[model samples]
Target: MKLRQVVPWGFTAIVAVLIGNGVLSQLTARGLTNTVNEVMQGYRVQTSLQALEQVIVDLQLGERGFIITRDPDFLRPYQTAQSNLAQEFARAKTLLQNEPAQLQNLNELEALSNEAIAVLSNNIARVRNGETPSSEELIQGNQVIEQVRVKVAQMLQAESQTLATRKDIVTRAEILSAISTLGGTLLGTLLGLSIVGFVIRQVVQPINQVTLAITSSSTEIAATVAQQEHFATEQATSVHQTNSIMEELGASSRQSAEQAQKTATGAQEVSQLAETGIQAVSYTLEDMSVLKAKVEQIAQQILHLSQQTDRIGNISELVTALANQTNMLALNAAVEAVRAGDSGRGFAIIAEEIRKLADQSKNSAAKIGVLVSDIQKAIAATAIATQEGTQTVENSLKTAEGMAQTFTGVTTAISSVALNNQQISLNAQQQAIAIQQVVSAMNSLNEGAAQTANGISQTKISTQKLNEAALDLQAVV
Candidate 1:
């Protein structure tokens, strides 16, 4: 059966046993009181019958004294006895009213007493009137007194028998009350012990078993959560260190790329200056060829002037010989005119004038021969200087062509170094992006581990509280 039904029924049975014991005790007490009261009434009835017999004896003594002395003092006792005897008989009749046999005895005793009193009264009146009474009348009065005494003895015997019967009934009621009280006490004690034992077996033991299992399970769960939280914290720290290293590498790569760009710009400017120098060298070579041709033409004109001065020297020598022959002819004509007298004098004067003209012609031919010899010496020095100037111009044109070829090779090497720097910059940017993603994921895992640890701690506290409550319930039961 369920505990709900068993507990109430057990209490009800205990109450029923107590009520039955109380009712039985009350009934036993009431029966003993009633039997004692009836025994006391029987004793009162026996006392009243004995008092009636005493009153009858007093009447007989008073009558005997008055009849022998014939005195008035004796008559006073007789008169008193007569008055009290009727009252005693009336009291006896009232006490025995429930007993039919005792009442019949009292009636017969009343008739005998009346007859004795009448006999005594008649003899007393005869003595008072001065007459003598006969002996047979006195004998008849004595017989009646004897009959009254016999009837009183029989009534006293009947009261004694009734008193014995009432005592026996009181004894039997006391015995029955004792037996019933002892039996009820034993039955009630046994029933109460049975109810107590049943309750301990059904309720308290099962609750203790369930509480112990819950405390053990909560302890294990709390330990597992603590270990997981420690692992997550360590992982987050490692990810943060990796992210710092990636940022430093990216900064260095950008600086190298900028320096390479500056070197490429300087190389392009040098290539442009070299092309301009080659154009200027070609123009200088053309100007030296034009100057060599002009020097050759001046040498040919000086040679032609030297040949014309030698021809002038040969013509001045022929004029000097003709002037000397004219002077000798004038001298011979002057001597022949003296030998002939007056006719030869006129011919001598004409011959003297011809001799003066011939001397002036000879001096003019000598000055022309000295001027032609100086002109021929200057033409010979001009021809030697023109040949040396033509050899120096040919050596300068060959050196300018070799310098132009060296500048072209330097411009090609600078362009190749600039292309390699751009590829390194691109790779650094991709590595920085990947490191940032790893740092974000580690932070999320750390937060989840902290929340799990908090939940496990709360569960452990609740389990402790439940264990305490179970212990309190065990104490109460």
Candidate 2:
């Protein structure tokens, strides 16, 4: 027989039983574990506390034994008490197997207690054997016992903290689980009752609602499938874009590094050009020195011209003496010319014109002398200017050489940079290629993502429709 036909109620009963039992079992385990942990933790705390109490009691007893009896045999109980503390310590250690801090405290207490016992034993023995007990010795014994008690108390506080933390964690976990189980039980009971009610209502309701719900679920599944395909396409596109950008960046970096190397090279070339220009300027200045000496010789020629002018002035003075005699002679000639007037007039006119010509020649000579002096001065100035010009030129040449060297270095550096840039471009190309590959991969991934999203969308749509159909059934049932 089919399961639903032969034992429809059987399956329901089984599910209810399983769910109820599972929840109950989980709750029971949580409770039981909490109980066990609590018992173990409490036992440890109690054992540690009992150990501390025992130590305190033994300390008191030892003090009393020495005080009252003043006998060596009285020290026996104190000694035995010290020995018995080891057993109590062992018990605490065993109980605190998981409580390391408490066990450490127990060890310290044991040590302190033993020390007090030994001191008390020695004192009691001394007194019993005929020495009187001193007040100082008794006080010292009390102090040692006090120290042990303080340490035990501190340990107890630490253990209590640990217990509280454990208890809180257990309580929260158990309570939460109990609440969950209770909620589950309530939900299951309501659902079971509704299902029974639904069967009775189903007999009267039309079946068309079921058909419509199934059709709607199919439509939702188809829509989900379409969405998934679109998502995959979008993912593929994004992947491609990312890959392309990475390739571009890698290429650009390589280009920049190359450019820097080229610039450094150009700077070195510029430095060399500056040195060459400086050397050329030095040579031009050396030629200017020779030209300056020639200018100085021209100044001496002007000085000679001045001397010649002085000689011409002396000659003009002699000519004037001669001219006076000639004038005397000319006067006698004019007397003769008066006897022969027309012929003499022409001679007189010629004499006047000759005198005027002599005067003009003397003036011209003086002017020529002045002109020579000026020329000499100008030559000197020119020579001075030439010398200055040579120096200026020399300085300018030096500057030019310096500039040329700087420029040459710059050019060389620029060339190198250009070459580096070329290399960078090459690297960029490679990177671009890599990026293209990445983009391709991303595209593939995006396609896959789109497919996955499409699938998820389809699944979600189908699930939603199923849920809707389930809701619709609620109305009939």
Q: Compute the lDDT of residue 184 as modeled in candidate 1.
A: 43
Alpha-carbon TM-score of each model against the true structure: 0.44, 0.37
**Candidate 2 global TM-score:** 0.37
lDDT of 1 by residue, 58-118 (tens): 5655555556656677667578878988888888788778778878988988898889888
Worst 10 residues of 2 by lDDT: 2-11
Candidate 1: worst-modelled 10 consecutive residues by lDDT = 413-422
Residue 417 error, candidate 2, Å: 99
TM-score winner: 1
Per-prediction backbone clash count? 0, 26
Superposed on all Cα atoms, the candidates' RMSDs to the truth, in angstroms, are 98.8, 63.0
